[model samples]
Target: MLRIHFSSGDLARTRIAEEPDPLWETVLSLQQLREKSREPVLDGWRRRRCARGGRALRTLSPLMPSRGYFPDFLTPAEGSGGLESGIDAVLSTPRRQLCGELELLADHNPLPSEVRRLAEGETGALRRLGRALRDYHASVLEPGWRDIASRIEGDRRHRTETQCRLGTEEMLRSFAPLMGWQSPVLCADYPVERDVHLQGRGLLLVPSYFCRRTPVALLDETLWPVLVYPARPLCSDTPAAPSARLAPLLGHTRAAVLQALQTPRTTSELARCTGVSVSSASEHATVLRRAGLVASTRQRHHVRHTLTQLGDHLLTGVQLGRIPPPSASRHHGRA
Candidate 1:
């Protein structure tokens, strides 16, 4: 069990990551590739076939074993910036920290030849690690980035909705079955028994697409507190065509607009995704908002739209053939 103790100050500072961190996704996805979890959502990504002959798979395999501690430097906080920036941070790890983390990894598991150079802090070893990370992301992650991004965005949207509707603590508690929130401590299922006292640094909850079953944390508690938890499956980037009832009832373009909103998008962005003009997108959004199917928030000139709880349930139910036509008691309309 992993218990994360939070103080009042810590609670005030705690916040969810705005988007997926590329390095975290890369490292966790590599681990997922090594393991045989065979989750359906990952099956599409897995089919890409990470060939062992590939420099990325061979070089990175040793570090990301099926279990146990992986080096923390591999996923630096700079990852919040983007991929290249994150890789730069990984490559620029000070020798002292590099050696210490590698030593810790070695203590738990046998260090392979590829990683031994890193353990010894040999020249250019970090550069090689950087290349392997970039190569794997290009080969595996970049290809399906849209799908990955949308899925993570969907999870973030759900979290935001939860936080807005019910207080922050309620949002934390909503992670039940996966995690339990008992006031000061948030409990999670983990391979080891550990306690993380947030003190006052706060915790950054990073949602990941590939961190299946268990949440991951940095072995070194001194660094910023970060928890990478599995993101909830929302929808495929290119969702299946709207259900027969959905398309006919909402009309095709509006239905397409609704599907495009699985992840929040601005008016122009929505127009591009739904293949409609900007005005059309705006019109569709206004109607959906009136029906309580979508909630729109304006940020200067552009307005971002996301599915409301009613919209989410309606779309999900109709797609699954579980929802019937709405009655006057329940507010909503066609598209």
Candidate 2:
């Protein structure tokens, strides 16, 4: 079991990541690709990845093994910002840290020539790794990114509501079967035996679409404290595409706007995602808002639209899972 010890100040400082961490997802997805363990859910996604990832695999496979410790530097804190910044952070890892982590990896798996060069801080090897990260994300991850983001968003929203309705402590407790929250100490079943003490720095709760079995933490706890847990929501990784059930009723463009609003988007962003004019996107959001399906809030010059409860129901028409009370004991459920 991995135990995380927290202090009162740690509880006060604890918070959730604002967005998905791209590099973290990239690393976890690579693990999923190799294990092919999630069965029907990830089967199709795995197949697609296998077909397109040969070039990227040549560079990334040796660095990230099917199991055991992968380099913490591969998933930098900057990853929450986006892919470019994340890649930049990875490439900029201190040479000393790079060499040390690679040495650890080599203890278990033989490093390829490219990976060896990377450990040596060779510029060419670092450049190739960057290209592989980008190519892999573009080909393997980008396709399911929208659905992935939506799932994580749903999990975050559930946690946020729990925090507000009960309290932060209660929200923490809600993790339940996935994590045992017993006040100052949180516990979970882990692949390796380890303990993480918050030591007053607090913790960052990161929900991941690809993370499975057990939550993950940085191998190096000295970095900002993060607890990455699985956010399996709504559908499987490769759920068959939903038939256009809502499109005809709402009209194609309006329906597109509704779907794009799944994770919140500005009018311009909505326009881009739905391939509609800016004015059209704005108009649709207004219509959806008036219809009690979307909520829009102004942030400076941009208005962001998000699905309201009714809107969410209209879009999904499915019950989202809820974090059970600490007594539940069972891990995941759609309560």
Candidate 3:
């Protein structure tokens, strides 16, 4: 069970208590904000942009919150009008938690490569935004899970197709003017290319609504909850999230092998620490490399093995015990 409270302003003083069953407070506190816009002129431009491509307004959709939670577009206040009155509720909550939940719920999501295209060289922005949404879910949402169940009943729940698209279009339109003026000089020639990347990447454009500075939110939309990050922030830099995926190996043997490999190592050294035969050690390395967990680089006559991102994740998981051991899963098999 988790508990959370929200307020219109002064978050710390708002009595917005949030608690998750496992106490994922660290994951829930980072917070996410977005660029809000109020320019109808920009909206008209975005409509033209949408028309240029076969992509309709229907293509721009909002990422919904998890199924069990209340639809963000709805409010606790009974008889509130649709959307307009519920705007704050729809936008509230940290962005990181939303992104994480969406990833957990959906089958496919954007990775670094997709993100780079959307960000236009703003990797740091994407990361911070993703993390912020995840944190919001963990910290601000209500504890009673069932409270949201009835509201989300079956097909017509939470985010309707139209509502979702409208929200997304509104955000994109807000950025149109800026995209025309502030974007790279070459961007004008390649408008469609830029548009595809930005919209595909979940970039939000807000007018001068939040501030006079440039406004946008690079968000993670795949996550069910949807994560967001502010475009032009007041802070020097936003907080970062701990890696979501873990390293691929576990146990003392794997740890020892990794530590010894400041430079890549031979199977013999791996076997010595692992207390296995050279043949057995070589087999383990082979499996790791095949899984993209380790890399092999040639050094003289010997082929040395070094851990890759997945391999490092295995090691981290072993240390943290947050993820299950590699051996426990059939995918890893016996090595």
**Every candidate's CA RMSD:** 14.7, 18.3, 22.4
lDDT of candidate 3 over 239-324, digit per residue (tens): 21112112232443344445434335676545543344568668767766777778987778767788776666654544523444
lDDT of 2 by residue, 1-335 (tens): 67889899998888878899888888888888788666343565566656446788788888888788899999998999999999999999999999999999989888878788898899999999999999888877787788778888978888888888887777776564356565667776688778899899989999998898779999897899998999846544444222245767887557767766766778765664454567987998999899998999999999999999887877777655556665667765545
Best by lDDT: 2
TM-scores for every predicted model: 0.67, 0.68, 0.20
lDDT of 1 by residue, 1-335 (tens): 78889898988788889978999988888777667656443465567665632778888877877788888998999999999999888888888898898888888788777687886677677778888888888877887788678888888888878878886676786564366566777876678889999999988989898888778999889899999988877655445444333878898667767766776888866765454567988999999999999999989987899999888877777453445678989876543
Model 2: what TM-score? 0.68
The lDDT for every candidate, in the order shown, is 0.79, 0.80, 0.32
Q: Which stretches of candidate 3 lie over 4 Å from their true place?
A: 1-263, 317-335
Q: Which candidate is the best by TM-score?
A: 2
